[model samples]
Target: MKNINSKKLLPINMNSIIEGHMVIIKPISKKEINKTYLSWLNDSQINKYLEVRHNKQTINGIFDYVNSHRSRENSEVFAIFTKKGIHIGNIGVIYDKDNKYVEYGIMIGNKKAQMLGLGGEATILMFEFLFKNKGFRKIFNGVISKNESSWKLFESIGSTREGILRGQCICSSKKPCDVYLYGILRKEWLNSRKKYLNILKNIKIKNG
Candidate 1:
């Protein structure tokens, strides 16, 4: 990566939001709910590591969940879609208003769309939104220790591993796994965004 140039850095007040090559992050709405995205909760493979997917899910139940989340003032939930408008996943930040921080999460629900760097792009866009638009200074996230790939993803985006909760989550094989906590400060993001944006700029969008 080259040194970030003042000209190449992203503008803080850009009007268009959620633009990306492999994916687009659109605010979650009742109108966007569908069988594909809804099925993710019921899919054992897709929801293996997610705490919210532990119970059985129905269309009505999922609908209620979305409605309840939308009612919140501090949540910024969004549906992750492919450039061609195919729904693949969701991502968002849960704000801790009193503490002046946020906890973030993301999921790429479609198995067919996994491993294509779509989730990574959606995450970067969401982080940029939090830091630039929403005025959030501290952002935090966690990944199951068993899920090495996810931890790597966060590290690649410049998050620092702060702590670990051992044996907190029971895994698919019935073994307890740790959850690795990571965080990003505003100063770190200011530096990281430049390198990340450069990478995004160089990435070739296949029919995006």
Candidate 2:
């Protein structure tokens, strides 16, 4: 089997914030890792499709996890904040330098913030930043098969359903769940930027 070296020694330089009309993503800080953040990981419903749900989470564990990524060069974690400056969730990326690609994961920790399309806005912002600013060739995302909304959101951003990793995740259901791999090339996203921007504009206007 060919080894996939996902980590790189180069820093992501996540100092600048990526902003959308509805949300802004900035590097996560130690101050943000509080009890509420801890609860997001431990909540069964919140983490139903997340691997972190497999283990019980504590404040210390959450801190350690956040710190580990903070100190890593290839990994970046960002706190998702609304235009009102409320921190609602977190998104992260790990650079697969060898493959010239990036893998991302996201979670909307605040229940009140869920279903408002904030996650979608954050995702578009992330894609634009990584593709236009970072010079990455591609971006990848994976979703549990049962998470229809998540996968559909990714598709709306022009990511293709690349493949399925059979029984890759043991979900909260205690049953093995297939993982849906979604990927988008930088050029493809760039080409569709106008269409997506229009959609985003409509969403903003509608929401406001």
- Cα-based TM-score, every candidate: 0.83, 0.86
lDDT of 2: 0.79
Angstrom error of the Cα, residue 147, model 1: value is 1.4
Candidate 2 wrong stretches, greater than 4 Å = 1-12, 199-208
TM-score between candidate 2 and the true structure? 0.86
Error of 1 at 186 (Å): 1.1
What's the number of clashes in each of the models?
0, 0
Per-residue alpha-carbon lDDT of candidate 1 for residues 34-67, written as tens digits (9 for 90 to 100): 6766688888888888876568876666555554
Residue pairs whose backbone atoms clash in candidate 1: none
**Candidate 1 Cα errors over 4 Å, as ranges:** 1-17, 199-208
**Model 1 alpha-carbon miss at residue 54, Å:** 2.0
lDDT of 2 at 99: 87
> Considering every candidate listed, which one attains the maximal TM-score?
2
The CA lDDT of each predicted structure is 0.73, 0.79
